[model samples]
Target: MALLEVRDLVVSYGKIRAVKGISFDVEEGQIVCLIGTNGAGKTTTLRTLSGLIRPAKGSISFDGTALTSVPAHKIVSLGMAHSPEGRRIFPRMTVEENLRLGAYSRRDKETDDDLRKVFDLFPVLAERRSQPAGTFSGGEQQMLAMGRAMMSRPRLLLLDEPSMGLSPLMMKKIMSTVADLRAGGTTILLVEQNAQAALKLADVGYVLEVGKIVLSGTGPELLTSDEVRKAYLGED
Candidate 1:
């Protein structure tokens, strides 16, 4: 069974439907990416999967359990962790403190080991362990967000717009880290606005347009697709 499965998912804000019956799946240990332009409901989809927003319609299942009604905090204990868009780190909290908060649902004794692993992933986080999260650069904050999510030891990782507002070098660094996480056996469902970067790092890619999935394929296939090229890849 797929580690994560979303079927006919629909969501709305008040009267406006932001997601309209989208279905997708992420197999265990695979990197599945949702790539789209702004307003395509990419963030909304991630938010829904993470239990931040209740879907107006459709079902979300993770590892054979229904998640549509699960509370956001409860979802973390189910082994799904979300690094939301905008890197919402607590401004006043120290880096280590912010990371500790991510493990709030856990009762495991290996938290220190996990912390070491996260520090290994982003060495700068270790250097700034006592610094306020808000004092870091944008890329540093993004790393902290991902690190915080990893502290949960999640079976499925949800990343939304990890490369948003980053420089070219920082973008490359973040994408590389994502690849490493997948290689290390974390199933990831990524939502990204950088279509090229997302598709390249993904094993499978879906193109979401205006809250609907218009195309789905392997990473390389979508990267070379003529329609995708014109519409998202900035090529004529």
Candidate 2:
């Protein structure tokens, strides 16, 4: 069975529908990416999976448990972590404090160990552990956001736009970190606007246009697809 599954998922905001009956699955130990332009409902989908948004129709199953009605806070306890778009770190909090907050759902005593692991993944975070999150650069903040999510020891990690506004070098660093996470056996569902970068790191790729999936393929297949090349990769 897939580690995470969404079937006929539908989400709406009042009279307007943002996601229209889309379906997909992420198997264990794989990086599944949903690539699209702005307003394609990529963020909405991640929010729905994280229980931040209620779906109007359909079901979400993670590890064989139905998550359709789970509360947002409770979802984290179930081993799903969402690193939302825009790197919404607590600006006034120290980097260590922010990472601690991500373990709110945990009752175990491994938080310190997890914190160390996060610092190892992004060594810069270790250097800035005592500093306020707002003082960090864009790439550093992004690292903190992802590290915070990692604090939960999640079985499934949902990442939304991890490379939004970083320099090309920073973008590469962020994507490399993602690959490392997957290599360490963390399942990931990534939403990204940078199709080339996302597809390069993905095991499977789905293309969403205005809330509907228009194409699905393996990473390399989508990278070479004519339609994907024209619409997302800027290849004429």
Candidate 3:
């Protein structure tokens, strides 16, 4: 069974429907990416999957359990973690404090070990554990966001716009770490605006336009697609 499955998910804000009947799946250990421009509901889909926003219609299944009615904290314990858009790190909180919050759903004793793992993945965070997250650079904050999510020991990692605003060099580094996380056995469901960077690493890719998935394919196939190139990849 797929590690994460979303079917016919529909979400709205009062009168406006943001996500329209989208269905997708992420097999264990694969990078499945959702790509679209602003206002395409990419962030909304991630928010809904993470249980921050309830879907108006549809079902979300994670590792065989239905997640529609599961509360957000419960969803975290179910081994799904979301690193949301804008790298929403707490400005006043110390880096360690922010990371500790990610493990709040756990009742186990391995949080210290997992904390070490996050440090290993982001050594700079380790070096600055006592510093305020807001004092860090954008790239550093992005790393902290991902590190914080990793604190949950998630089976499936949902990353939204991991590369939203960063230097080209930092973006490359963050994207590589995403691949490494998959290599280490965490399935990833990614929503990114950097279509070229995202599709390059994705095993499967879906194109969302105006809240609907307009096309789907293997990453390379979509990379070669003329329509995708024209619309998202900055080609003719």
Q: State the lDDT of candidate 3 residue by residue for 1-236, as single tens digits.
A: 78888999999989999999999999998999999999999999988988999999999999899999999999999999999899999989999999999899999888999999999988999999999999999889999999999999999999999987899999999999999999999999888889999999999999999999999999999999999999999999
Residue pairs that clash (backbone atoms under 3 angstroms), model 1: none
Candidate 2 regions exceeding 4 Å error are: none
lDDT of 2 by residue, 1-236 (tens): 89999999999999989999999999999999999888999999999999999999999999999999999889999999999999999999999999999999999998999999999999998998999999998888999999999999999999999998899999999999999999998999999989999999999999999999999999999999999999998999
Q: Could you give me the TM-score of model 2 versus the true structure?
A: 0.99
* Full-model lDDT, candidate 1: 0.94
The ten-residue window of minimal lDDT in model 1 covers: 185-194
- Model 3, position 77: C-alpha lDDT score: 90
Looking at model 2, report the run of 10 residues with the lowest lDDT sum: 135-144
**Weakest 10 consecutive residues of candidate 3 by summed lDDT:** 186-195
Candidate 3 global TM-score = 0.98
Which candidate number would show the highest lDDT if scored against the true structure?
2
- What's the TM-score of every candidate structure? 0.98, 0.99, 0.98
RMSD over all Cα atoms, model 3:
0.8
